[model samples]
Target chain A: MGRWEPNATDRLVVAALELFETNGYENTTVIGIAERAGLTKSTFFRHFQDKREVLFGRSSLADVLAEGIAKAPADAEPLEAVACALELLAQDVFTPERRDFIARRQAVVATHPELREREALKGLGLIAAMTGALERRGLPALTARVTAELGALALELAYTRWGSASRDFTEVAREALDEVRSAAPAR
Target chain B: MGRWEPNATDRLVVAALELFETNGYENTTVIGIAERAGLTKSTFFRHFQDKREVLFGRSSLADVLAEGIAKAPADAEPLEAVACALELLAQDVFTPERRDFIARRQAVVATHPELREREALKGLGLIAAMTGALERRGLPALTARVTAELGALALELAYTRWGSASRDFTEVAREALDEVRSAAPAR
Candidate 1:
């Protein structure tokens, strides 16, 4: 057996996701999450403000995705760059073991109307960041916005598909991008 | 001058939006919103669950949008149907006065990370419903999802642009759709 011990933050997220999936989002409290994680309420508070934060604390992934977007080849077209960035993000962020957890997290967020609204805002922020990057590459405002929106939409669709199954996210994302390309009008 | 009396729900929404814009979301209280609307806290409770619901009580707008999707023309392609449905929704559901309220509500939601997430979830739910409607018209699951997502993104972009200025939403939405179409490879 591995001697690695899970950190308090990791344990809290796992426990919270489980409680959120098993019991219910509204019913799951910070105390319950902390106890389930085998930690004190103070420890949980140290990691997150409340139950809602536990599900959303994974926001670091957004920064990683942004970094991937920044690293796309300079010669790539706007759409191609976005697709490549999403592919990289899928490979790095949504590991196989995280698929089920993501699905459950989505389900929990879906069940709560407030949480759903928050999710949309987060998506819009990410798109805005991507738009800035595209603009820096000399794309026009409208074109950049559209490209970022398309990329975000494709990533969302691919994530949903991957979350619904056991497929690797990188593969699913690439396939989704291919599907989009094939469906587009021929050049 | 014409005598005008706003309904309780309308008054509440307007009051809440104003307060959210000026005082900020977390700082605005239910009692203050009720008082500004010329209603009691009890009356506010009769219409909504709590302070947060004052800004978010229009969940029925999703149903209205969904109905538009369901009522789209039978011969229309998936993207065309989605664009038309969103256009119809803008005309039928979101009026000029209501657009102001929506702008303020969006601003407040944007300022709060949690509220942003909740808004994302709501958009996702709307897109899912739109996807189901497209699927009923013979679109495959992935295609339906992508079309619906693209449509939703287009609508959001148009709404943001329209809400920022004095432009008509229906006109802006149609123009935004044209922009999306123009960006696509020639058919």
Candidate 2:
């Protein structure tokens, strides 16, 4: 049987979040995070370039979303296709157990205006990725861009709702999509 | 007959754009911008807190948009109300001559990452205003927030498309809204 073992990267991320919450982001240092993680500074550097990367590091969520969109049925409508992709990520990437980490990460990012901007950039990156995937699926550029943005919008709203810790993320996402569809005028 | 005259604020904005484009944003000093505008440094300070404010200064667009939403007919749906507000701002706030300044401001903001974040924050501010307006109209908090965000997304996309300097901003915005509505699944 496989035993649970935290890798260097996971250890660093956990340690960084703990220190950031306890000492504040500005007061927390790279050296302190590394020491708390029981790893050398070089090991920390090998895993992340700086303290910010602990929060901003590439996660499988982006990959899963992009891959899901790219591999969706070719005949699916654009927005439906985007929703399918997001649902796939919700199922595969954002599990119930990861809730604590995601919550802590959001709290840390919320504490600083600069970090919030970086978080915004990350959101923009997801939209851009989804846009590119839709474009590759033969959607027109403008349509793809708008549809991707809407999909990202749904994802964000769902994440916010799911933050309450009462329901599954996928269920929240499905309800969020329904809310968006209801909000708009029928075509 | 009425005569055309550029006021101090307008002169400073034009001068700041010129200096930012010509001398690069980092190298362009406030004094240089004021000198180019044929205004004293004190006059520049009277208008803007700093060089960044030259591009990021508050305008009437947010006020008009929020007011439009707040004043929409009581029976109007939340998203429809948001769209109407955007349409109103498009008609009132984005005049033909203002188009040039907006385009230049966007270009300057695009060249620098920091400025882009500031620009994004400005966008967030608009969304917050719109959300508050929707809340005033009795929409639920999450629904208002999501609807406002979608409106902001449409505005950003339309603004980007309108930067080409050919069509009226209102027309571009209308088309952008149409694109979003059409992209959603027909329920």
State how far residue A148 of model 2 sits from its true place (Å). 2.4
Q: Is the docking of candidate 1 incorrect, acceptable, medium or high quality?
A: acceptable
List, residue by residue over A101-184, the lDDT tens digit for candidate 1. Answer: 788788888988657655776777778888888888887887777677677777777878888977778888777767765554
lDDT of 2 at A167: 79
Best by TM-score: 2
Candidate 2: the clashing residue pairs are none
Where model 2 places Cα greater than 4 Å from the true spot, the runs are A1-6, A40-46, A58-60, B1-9, B34-50, B77-80, B87-92
* Candidate 2 lDDT score at position A71: 82
- The reply for model 1, stretches above 4 Å from the true place, is A1-6, A14-38, A95-129, A160-168, A183-187, B1-6, B21-24, B96-121, B164-167, B184-187
lDDT for each of the candidates?
0.76, 0.80
**Residue B39: error of model 1 in Å?**
2.5
Task: Provide TM-scores for the models.
Answer: 0.76, 0.83
Expressed as tens digits, the lDDT of each residue in B1-187 for candidate 1 is: 2223459888898898888789888898899998999888888888889877666766465666667777788888777787777777777766786777677777888987656656666677778788888888887776677677667777877878877878777788777777775665322
